[model samples]
Target chain A: MMPVGNLVGMVVRNTVRSPRHFALSAFGIVIGIASFVFFLGLSMGVRNVILGKIFPLEVVEVVAPRASFMGKDITKKLDDGTVEMIRARPEVKEATPRMKVAFPAAGFGMFEGQEIKFEVGGFCDGVDPKVLADDPKLAALFKDWEAAGADDPAKTVACVPPVVDDKGVAGKNPCPDPEFYYCDVQDNRCHRRVPVIVSPTLLELYNGQVASTHGLPVIGDLEQFVVERGGLARMRFTIALGETMVAGSAMATSDKKRRVEGMLIGITPKAMPIGMTVPIEYTRRWNQEFAGDEAASTYSSIVVTLNDKDRLAVFSAWLQEQDLRLEDQLGERFATAIFIVTTLFVLISFTIVTISSINIAHNFFMQVSERRREIGVLRAVGATRTDVKLIILGEAALIGVIGGLLGVGIAFAGAALVDWASATYLPRFPFKPPTYFDFKGWIIAGGLGFSTVFCVVGGYLPARKAAKLPPAQALAAQ
Target chain B: MSEAVIKLRDVKKSYGSGAARTPVLRGVSFEVARGELIALVGQSGSGKSTLLNIIGGLDTADAGDVEVLGHDIRKIGEKELAGLRNSSIGFVFQAFNLLDHLTCLGNVTLPASFTPGAKDVEARGLEALRRVGLVELAQRHPSELSGGQKQRVAIARALFGAPKLLLCDEPTGSLDSETGREVIEFFRELNEKDQMTLVIVTHERRVSSVARRIIAIRDGQLVDGEELALGAPGDAGGAGAGGPA
Candidate 1:
């Protein structure tokens, strides 16, 4: 064989001479390759975001009182009595009863005609400490809480984190109504005051405002959180009560702040677990006299943290066996939907790439036919069928590479746009957005490889035609 | 010591099938000696082109012996035939058939690119172009050249490989009478100076004069082959009985 360099030069010259045709043929292939890459990236990214990073790792099973869109008809409420029943079960490692106060939801403590809206504080019984040690993700946060106060470590006290809003905790806890504090006060309301662990999306909502107001440095201050449902709402004596508790915090980080209301709610890692509390006796005493909502007195939900995350399904199934209903709500369902969408995106992209490859093949076929005489002349002189095939296939591979790069660029831009959009909308809706960029490499590289193969396949028809052209007739075509 | 470059005995060819299977070449017998310049001339539908194609290894004969350079074309497969065509012979067509994409130099270098150990094909290509007085136009593409220039490029391409025989199929049909005459003179020079075997299939009176031997075909059979004198001979132009079947 002659030097590959010479052959390459000839191919380049031939392709360049008819630049219009060459460009047209490769255009479809390039676009196809790009689409494949983009789709793959997005799918992989979605998978990573949804599954790779989520909080409240230990508190796997949550018993909520509220009926979701796909409501499960539960026969009874999981109050203090139900928590005791769950504790008696063999599969249940540690069952803690938590409650959500409705009187606070109706209205918070008002001072000097300035009424403060009370956040639905999640209250839980003190954890056995062994449960925290069993789960790694929970152990870190438990250690952080323990470090906050080692002396009388509020082991069974209710801890509320301050709402780190856009203006950073807005005010100091020096006054009685700290929630309505002004922006100028440099206080510990954001960090030490409340131990607020928000969603990554919601974090932007506060925009480090809580950090500055809390008089604490923002670095290493943030925490991971998860929220699980508070068990059933029950009406007792003319009061419709819904009491949910945020678990996983021993005591509020600061001494001045008794309780703080986080703006966002629902079952997420950012929301506290259903187990951590100031002790059930203290919760009954706080709600019975301080607030008139009678139903808030009982344990509305029993939060069960198992020995292993994999055992969650077994525990949940056991709960069902005991006639206790387990329902996954709209938010968790929405995460599952993300996976489906990513799968569809991949399929659609592959289809587009396939079509583009076909288009490239058609273009090459026509080109070979048009250049039959040239092919024959080459053959007559000394070009082998292999040489002709190489030129065609080489062109296709080039198209795939160029297209793949372009597609990756497009995918990056798309991911950025999605991130921007989520940042803008997540806090307002009070739901955390999953992280991005997890599956990028697989999508981009795999897409490129797939697209290149498609392009090469497209080149097959034209290559065969070029090889099959009779030197006699092809030469005689002139 | 007079080895035959091409040998054919009772070679036959047909097209289609059943009643439609029209036999093109029937029982043709011939031999082309090494370094022999012989012109095979015939009218339209004389099957001269078919015979030429068989000899060039571009088409296969149905029956009988057909050999070129010690390889039997009838028995050998398409691959060997193609190899034979590429290494042993060169062709010049009526239309000049130059690739539009390649320059005159690129065109001439194409054939030798196929042959093994033909590494310095480009230099030989340039030499061939120089011989045709188109060395300066080597970079110019075929479309950039005139009809006469294109044909000259084709001639250069044929000579670049240094094949045993240069096959011409009405090589001057597309050019004017003057350019055609000039092309014939170049063939004469090639035959006389380099002893290049030049087979020109033509109907032109002046074209045949360049060749020492002229063979005429009527239908598929060879009817006449005679030595031509330097000056005008008796009925040399239409002396053969070969015409349209």
Candidate 2:
């Protein structure tokens, strides 16, 4: 066998001598690798938007099962005790209890001096502040402001109450800082505006569908809107307690409705899919005041975060035993569909690569036939059969490296083009990603490795054929 | 005689299968002493080239006790045979088989690549080119050189390993008579000054004329001159004889 350096030198020299042949032989590999990279990147990007935004996989929502008509009595209320029990389980990282505002409510907000009113009857939930811990800014702003003022009276700011007329209408006596304080009409007292969070999915839906349809300006950047633009102060709204637009007078607890202010703090995946989420203390207070103490203490559902998502099956089984069920079956179905599509794309890429390798084999066989005399000359000068084989395989590996790099570059260019086209021409849709492809480091490395391995595999038989050629016969070959 | 560098006894080789088989070398035997220059003269199909290939460890004999530099050619594995060929024997062919892509120096240094830890390979290659009087043309590719220059480059490559024996198969077959004569003279000079052992397999009279002894073959069997040269008791049959000088 020859020294590795010399062998490599010879292989490079031989390979470079015929660039046209190398390019033709490597074309199949380039196409195969490009397709492979493009498909994998696209799948990853789509999966990110689907799983990360539309239906997150980190936490599973567990709710009490409905009672059966046969009176099986399997329905267990989700409460503080149940939350503690779930949190104590080894598989559960956290169990955050969420309660729906049992009383009727409606919100009217002013944004840029334009009034927007919406019913909050089925669109409001309350959760613990710890649910927003992943985002420091959100966590800081989403605390129970009522509890904070109660804990320290110094945190409270005094405000004048709005004067009410005999017709059940009130004159505005807005608090100096509506973000943190509200003039409550019922108690004639100042209270903090309930810090609320909305889901990122809601923002996406509004931007992609609602805002476009209504010719409203979309919330372009979440960070800028929530942090840099005075956060909650920019989106202050009044929530009328014990009243709702859906059932006007019938659902009201009294003829005179109590009004408190609410503010949008931040958006997060932990928030309700189509609702405003406030700190649990505020909901508990409101539920107790308008409904009953039982409504305040019992939770509507619990969000269970797992330490390892792989242990979801065990956790789900435990939930089933507790007469609870996971509420995100749509997420599972989406995941399965995405997985099947990704696998099919991968299989098609693999088939292209496999066929390309056969092309490489055919090209190498022709090269060997053409270079019979060259092989004989090398053998005559002291190269062994193994040396010849190494030289040929080395050339194949070089071609693979070149082809792999080119393929990946082309895939990136293709992705950029697709993203550009989507941004420039395609209509906006919910959960549409900024780019349609994600070229992770592993995918690039795997693409290069896959190309090189297949090329070497293709060259093996031809290399063996070259090695087996008798030096004398090879020399005599024309 | 000086210790034999190559010894062959009852060597036999054939081509093709049973019914179609044609014998190429039949019970042929000879010894080449160290530092001796000899020629094996035969017609195209008489198997002189095949005999040379067997001696060089490039081809296996069907039956034989063949030894070169004291290593049994038949008993050793392919790797050992390759090592023997790489270090102890050199081959020169009629086509001046230089890799066309490489320069003269590159072609000459090709053999050193297979010899591990071969120090000063480039310097040694230059020296080999110097010995062949082609040092000035070291950077020239084979396609740019004359037929005689290419053959000299081939010779330089063959001498790169400083092999004990040089085997030439029609080394001047592609050259003009004048250039062929010059190459033959260079071989004679190498034999005389460097004490290099050489086996020339050729049908040309000029190549045979320069050798110290000539062994003629007919119908795949050695004729008279080899028996006389080896001092074996045998009848002097029809042969092309050229005894020591």
Candidate 3:
């Protein structure tokens, strides 16, 4: 019986003694493992961003009852009454209504002598601020999130009216704090800018459609565009107070158009595609003045933020009972496509790794043939059959470790390169993930473990062949 | 009354199968008492090496019992045979099978490393080199050593584990006349000074002359014991045994 320590020493010494042999055996594994890690990083990045960041983990979207190609005529509008009713449900923590409107108005102007202008016309949304402000947990979602604020001084707190007595502070409601964009909702008086929660979809649409058509340099993820490119710079725009209008287009009366400076506050999740979310009260005021007897009392959609993810199915079931439909942005077509591509990527990765293992086995067999005399010498000295087998397997394990580490390095470098390219050249890509790769520790470990196990298994048969040789015959081989 | 240190009975060995099968050993038999200096003399393919392999536990006999250091080769498992080989027998080949990658000391220590619970391998290796007068060349690799020095290193490795039996196959077959003579003298010294039990296979007359007993093999069978006899100069100072005490 060979001492285990001596066997280990011999294994290491013999393996390290032949540098060329070691490297050749490990190279195949390195290529295989690197491809596995690289492709996996890509698939995982797309899955997380599409399923996690964009769609979010919990919150579900409920669109109003409307005519659809499916021909399901459920006449329950997602109005304020629906929002209240949904909010009253046990599974629903808070329900926020989202109203869609065309870009109120967009034009370029000089603010502090900096030229700024809206380059595209996107949709907008009117939202009541109470959703985030009242629910601490929901507000917590936007706590650290921020958009590139317009540097216009008028949009700041300078126009904030002082706190008034209970009788009312001059106006029924002044801008609630510095975060509020406007005040004096009773008469639509001018005060600061309008606080708005802009959805990330607006940036995606502009970058994808408007920027490409105009041949402009594309913007990266929302944060980079907002912070580095000053995306919200042109917050001051005048929209027609009438029902239908465009910035440069005409309205029934020019006087009907009102001027308001809008300030971007936070970002809305992509699952809720409502454009820019503004104060619903201000939007109601405009609607009352223009729509005569029919102001939009029902909302375009309601977003139900769940208290617990476990209750999402319950809330979804209840929404169905109320004749509402939960809209999934990731439709069946997109889901099936992702599933097929992801499956293909995984199959390709496993095949490469398995083939590499077989290659490792072939290499070991050749090594055994070349080292037959050496194995005989070891046996002649005193090595048992098990010792010879251990030495061979130990060498294979070392190869696996070296290949695994190299694979991780290659994966990281490739990911970083892809991320840099995405930030610089491919920013308009539909999946606007904050970073193109997420190098989770467990994923890297799995890659390492898989390669090692395959290598050991691959080397087994050759090791046994070497070990079974009779010492006298083996000694005569050379 | 006691058994011999090494024994073989009707050991038969063949290579290949059926029509192509070539018999290498045919019912050959021998015994070596403790401390015997023996020479197994035969031409190449005369089965002397095959008999030595069976005695050393490196090869199994197809039909026979081979006992070395009280362990029956036919009855034991590979692990037990390996242990017997490790603890009781050491081999010196004509090629001086010293691993080129290892220093003289490393090659000498190799056998001890295979023995479980072996400790102070360097100390024991140095001691063996000291006995063989190659302590100064302990750090030199086989490639850098002279033929005589490499044989000395091989001898040192065989003696390192304090093996009970030293088996050499044409140990001087590759050396020149002068080097070969020196290796033979070294073997004589080990046998006489340490009372070491030795079984050497060789065709060289000079090598067999130093042995107390010479067994001639021909065509896988032992030559008649009476002609050459088990003991040469049987009256020469207890022959193989040291003076009484």
lDDT of 1 by residue, A1-478 (tens): 4347666677667666776875776666566655556555655565444443343233444565354455755435566677777777666677766554423212143222233332344423322233335446534333223233543223333324335578443222343333322111223332212122233433433335543554533222232221111211000001112322233333323132223222221112423332122223334544664454454545555667556555556777677776665445333454457757867776777777778778888888888888887777776666666766777776766666666666666666777777787777765321244544544556667867886788788888888888777667777663
lDDT of 3 by residue, A386-474 (tens): 98898899888888888888987888888888888878886445556657666677779987988788889889999999999888887
Candidate-wise lDDT, in order: 0.61, 0.84, 0.72
lDDT of 2 by residue, B1-245 (tens): 67888888889999999899999999888888888888888889898999999999878899979999999999988778778878888889999989988999999998887888889989999999999999999999999999999999999999999988999999999999999999999888888788899999999988877776777787778875253342211324423223331
- The sequence of per-residue lDDT tens digits that candidate 1 reaches over residues B87-154 is 66888888888888778998888765555555776788889999999999999989899999999999
Runs with alpha carbons beyond 4 Å of true place in candidate 1: A1-7, A53-335, A396-439, B75-81, B112-118, B224-245
TM-score of 2: 0.93
Model 1 Cα displacement at A138 (Å)?
A: 12
Name the docking class for model 3.
medium
Q: DockQ of each candidate's interface versus the true one?
A: 0.33, 0.71, 0.65
Tell me the tens digit of each residue's lDDT in model 3 across B1-245: 13478777788999899999999988877777777788989889999998888887777799988888888888988888888778778899988888887899999998877887888989999999998898998899899998988998998999988888899999999999999999898888877778788999999999988887788888888775321434433355434432210
Residues A1-478, model 2: lDDT tens digits: 6788888888899889999879877999999899999999998898888877787776789998778657675467788889999999999989999999887889997765467888885688999988777888778778886674354242344556777799645577566654567677556567767788888889988898878777777887766765655765677788888778775456665764577788887778889999899998888998898878988998989998889877888989988888788986677788889999989988988898899899999999999999999998878877889999999999988889889999999999999999999999998787777897888999999999999999999999999999999988888899
TM per candidate comes to: 0.66, 0.93, 0.78
Error of 3 at A66 (Å): 4.2
- When 2 and 3 are scored with lDDT, the better candidate is 2
Q: Of the candidates shown, which would achieve the greatest TM-score relative to the real structure?
A: 2
